[model samples]
Structures are given as C-alpha cells and as structure tokens.
Target: MPTPILVIDKLHIGYGHKVVIRDLSLEIREGEFVALLGASGSGKSSVLRTLAGFHSVMSGRIVLEGRDIT
Candidate 1:
C-alpha cells in the first residue's frame, strides 16, 4: 500500500472558549480526491482551517508526509 500524503491525527481544533472540532482524524493518500461534507456550523471549514494552520489546537497531532507538522 502507498503512504498517505496528509494525515490528520486526533486533531482538536477550536477558537477561544469554543471547540469546533474534537479528536477529528482522516487520511488522504497521494493523488486521492476528498471532500468535507456537513451542514452549516458543523466545523467542516474549521477542520480545513486547522489543517492550513489557521486555527489553534487544544491537543493532538497533525502529521503530513510522515512528519509531525502540528
């Protein structure tokens, strides 16, 4: 099997005093297409923002290409 290009491991992301996503995890393999599907206020964008390093994490790790980026 091939390795994942992006791995979100037990990510806990949120803003001040309000948690948007907790312990969220997923893996994206190389050349794979994925999407975040949810209703409004479901923290879908929050997860993407956290992966992009826009938000702060309360705990857990974000790994990318076998490296701990978080």
Candidate 2:
C-alpha cells in the first residue's frame, strides 16, 4: 500500500513496569478519522498518551509523514 499518514508498528506502551498497550500496530491514512474505543481504564487514554509521549513506549515504531516518530 502507499505510505500511510500515520503508521504504528509493534508498539508497547507502559507506565513503570505495568504495561498498558503492547504488540499493537496500526496505520491511519490521510483524511481518515480513527478513534480509540474501549471500556474505561482499558487504555484508551493510555494509547493517546503513548502517542503524545506522555506515557512510555516500551517498544515500537511510530511513523508520521514518512518520518519515524518513535
């Protein structure tokens, strides 16, 4: 596929030793709108925090505009 607007590869996010998000990979295309939906405390905000770098990404790659973000 053509390059995505955002690409997340094998992401692992956590706080301290407590893993919140792991083994997650996704791609968002331009003009696409994606939402994080889940139960409360199920890491929806945690995922957002991970992307915004507020939370720790234990492992993974985040690509934006063909640049690696993490």
Candidate 3:
C-alpha cells in the first residue's frame, strides 16, 4: 500500500468549550478522492476548516506528506 498524503489522527475539534468533533481519524492517499457527507451542523465544515488551518483542534494531529501540520 502507498503511504497516505494526508493523515488525520485522533482529531478532536470544537468551538470554545463545546466539542463538535471527537476522535476523528482519516487518511487520504495520492490519487485518491474523498468527501465529507453529513447533515447540517454535523461538523463537516469544521473538519474542512480544521484541515485548512482555519480552526484549531482540541487534540490529536494532522499530518501531511510525512510532516505534522497540526
């Protein structure tokens, strides 16, 4: 198997004291396509925002191409 280009490990995201996402882990390999599907206010945007450096995770790590980005 190829190494993943993006890795989100044990991610915990939230706003202030309210936790919106918890223990979310994901991996995206090269040439692979993925999407986030969920209902409204289901933390989908939060995950994307977190990955784009718009939001900070409460815990865990975000690794990109063998480097820790979070």
User: All candidates' lDDT scores?
Assistant: 0.85, 0.84, 0.96
Candidate 1 global lDDT: 0.85
Can you tell me which runs of candidate 1 are displaced by over 4 Å?
A: none
Q: What is the C-alpha lDDT profile of model 3 across 13-64, one tens digit per residue? A: 9999999999999999999989899999999999999989999999999999
Q: Which is the leading candidate under lDDT?
A: 3
Q: Stretches of candidate 3 above 4 Å error?
A: none
Over the stretch 9-69, how does candidate 1's per-residue lDDT look in tens digits? 8888777878888888888998899989999999998887878888768888888889988
Write out the backbone clash pairs for model 2: none
TM-score for each predicted model, relative to the true structure: 0.88, 0.88, 0.97
Predicted candidate 2 versus true structure: per-residue lDDT over 1-70, tens digit per residue: 6669888899888878888887999999877889888888788897887678776688998888988878
True-vs-predicted CA distance for residue 21, candidate 3, Å:
0.5
Error of 1 at 63 (Å): 0.9
Order by TM-score, highest first: 3, 1, 2
Candidate 1: residue 6 lDDT (0-100): 87
